[model samples]
Target chain A: MAYTKRIDGRKFNETRKMEAKVNIIKNADGSALFRFGDTIAIAAVYGPKPLHPQHLRNPEKGLLRCNYDMISFSVSERKRPGPTRRSQEISKVSEWALTPIVELEKYPNTVIDVHIIVLQANASTRCAGINAAALALANAGIPMKQLVSSVSVGKIDKKVVVDLIKEEEDYREGEGSTDIPLAFLSKSGEISLLQLDGKIRPKELDEAIKIGREASKEVYEIQKRALKAVGEEK
Target chain B: MIAEKKIIKQKVDEEREGKKKKREIAIPGEKIVSGKEYLPGDGTVREKDDIVARRFGLADISGRLVKVIPLSGIYMPRVGNIVIGRVEDVTFNGWILDLKSPYSSFLSVSECPRYIKGDLTEYYDIGDVLACKVVSVKHKSIDLTIKDRGLGKLDKGLIIHINSNKVPRVIGREGSMIKMIKDETGCEITVGQNGVVWISGSKVEDELKAKEAVLFVANKSYIEGLTDKVKKFFEGKRGGKK
Candidate 1:
């Protein structure tokens, strides 16, 4: 039973709708809220300030720290309040995804903390978190080479698709589903993050990345508009 | 020669005023301009033929230079910056000042000209606010000096904190905005590059008025006709007072 049609009727090269806003958190140095369909991610940036505990300070460059968490009420099954193993791993990967764009060398011995909270989750929460975190980092005025954009592309059976919804993720027909979440730097189109959750052939992964990169470009347009609109809004 | 220079200055000012209305804010990675004619300035980087913004702010073009004037960010400490800060800790030979910047700043007694007698705490105790000049800002160290006039202990005043990036707007062109606020409210306002402002006035009402004006300018830093708007703000306050 091959999964020929999309669960939501979206095109193979199409993504779930996305919404982005920046400077939403008042106290944070930078903050943003980004949404991909039902998944909602809010990110807050603090510092480039002095790092605590002393041990974590990087003498050569600043530290890029990320914390990603989904609220207890975000999912139907009720996520745990504290950090879990999966969230911890996501946090590490988000930090890695952000490090390429952020110029941490400018502030030596300091730490830039990015905290991401998922208010709702359907699928692709990590990608949405990265999106929000990128906006928040830019809003904080961190020196950066460029901005980052992320997308989650998956293959439902033989048909490779862009941005897999939860229903699509849960598809258990022929060949199951292969989830691939990716992040790309704006303009340069360099891959900063590439994660795979399911089995994928080398050829299929290449095609997924190609589709994901285009989808990320579209996301970049939305992110760019949101960033420009803020300083122009008076 | 002086008359000719004045005419040239006037023309420059007019050109700047005209350009303000069409000011565009550049986001990070956004290309400001292309070609060898324009040089990338602060907060901007040149990638091949294009000059893109490194910071998100107003894209300012002056002659052949392009720079992004950031609207908001933590203060990046630099040498030759006059900043206001509170004494966090009093040490043996120096004092630590919290300048609200990423880097920790220290004011050494050797840098202090008026350090003749008594303990360091006697001159600048913990929690004492001072207007100090940054003498040195190295990779791992920032040193402050109070060897000049108008740079020392702020005896009595109220402190207001704003985003460090808004300090330029509060100061304005040649201190025009600050002078306007001082004249309107009869207050002595000291704006710090680190965004800690000191306001001292004969009357509490005047001090508060000055604070309000400074905050107003900081909030609307990117707008055109800012001086005129600030004047109207003063007028509205006067009307309310009457």
Candidate 2:
């Protein structure tokens, strides 16, 4: 468990390079492109419009649905097109992460659909997807409690690290590695998403959460700036 | 920029005194008011004793009532609002119109002009544009009528779709914006409340200029002195005439 520098030359508590833009898709109600290091994700939001399949309409609040997909060439090896079980689970988790922030009661009986497409994958695609989706929702002008920001933290070489890349993710599968992805409502400081893989002690978990929280705050500032840029344009 | 800073400083001072400010942008889930002193309205929700904003919008307070005016969103169809729609489907009894809202509107045979005696398709076929009014909206269904004046088939006009919320800005204060475009470009323009705009001019240049002016209004609607800016923009294209 010797201390070793990350492959990307980032500090143990440091995250990867991040870039985000809003209103990138013309036809969609709202859209955003988000990049964290080498990983990139694009999200588009449609509706709060009428829900299809008459029976699925909720009398009280609108339904929020998410679909997470990875392009065939996103990975080093070509991925098969279409939804797999992994994508389905990620979609459900993304939907759960976003639903709490949306004010669904305002658009009762309608459906808000969020589509997240990963154009590149080095790691932390889900976290990047959540960030993009939040921007898209804001760009779409959907009513919500606040924008959500997320980051993935993990233990590598017996040290806590923020924003894991693909190589770090692979390392987590062996021996003593843990991956924790966390999301929060930036304005309210409320935790909207938390997922863990592998094993980590309570002390490490606390440390990971603290690092993730700080990283998410930085991401939230970027989200606000992107929204303001689009607002100023209008 | 100095004047803008002064205005912002004055607003901050007013806010410190607990006076309700006008046109403050509110982010989603941000608390607008506490206790039962204010009642929540549009773009806001009542959570226990607190009224919180439900979206990104401007806070509008009228006496004890508090509401949020959303800056962006899709058009929610309302009764009696005039909308421009494209015929999507031709049915036996009616034509399904895409009003650009979440819901499709129905223009039934009964609602069509009584003068039409033959097949409905022959009168208003698919892909035709129509200016219609929302006669009724019930649940998921929206009923439209085209029998009134200027509420029938639109022929050979350039259609421009904008943000539904910007429809008001396009029309401007007391119809000033629309009138300005019409006078300058000499194009017949019909703006639908649902964010659909139709422009037809005697010349191609006039049509393009009208489109350009409407888009400029939509883009710079939030800025001050937009009417004068728009006039300058149109005149600049016409060799600075007037």
Q: Candidate 1's residue-wise lDDT over A1-234, tens digit each?
A: 777678788889998889999999999999999999899999999998899879988899999999999999999998769989999999999999999998888888999999999999999999999999999998998888889999999988898999999989988888888898899999788998898888889899889999998999999998988888896577
**Candidate 2 DockQ score?**
0.58
lDDT of 2 by residue, B1-242 (tens): 89876775665555556654536666666778775656899888898888888777677766557798777789988888999999999888899999887777999988977666668889889999999999998876899998898889999969999988999889999999999999998899999999999999999889998999999999887777899999889778887544
CA lDDT for candidate 2: 0.86
The best candidate in terms of DockQ: 1
Report the C-alpha lDDT of model 2 over A78-153, residue by residue, as the tens digit. 9999999999999999999998888888777889999999999998999999999998997788988778999999
Listed per prediction, chain B TM-scores read 0.89, 0.85
TM-score of each: 0.94, 0.84
Checking candidate 2 for backbone clashes, the offending pairs are A145-B28, A145-B29
State the C-alpha lDDT per candidate: 0.89, 0.86
CA RMSD (A), model 1? 4.0
On a 0 to 1 TM-score scale, where does candidate 2 land against the true structure? 0.84
lDDT, candidate 1, at B97: 94
Q: What residue runs in model 2 are displaced by over 4 Å at the alpha carbon?
A: A4-11, A49-61, A78-81, A172-174, A187-190, B1-25, B31-41, B46-51, B58-67, B91-93, B110-118, B240-242
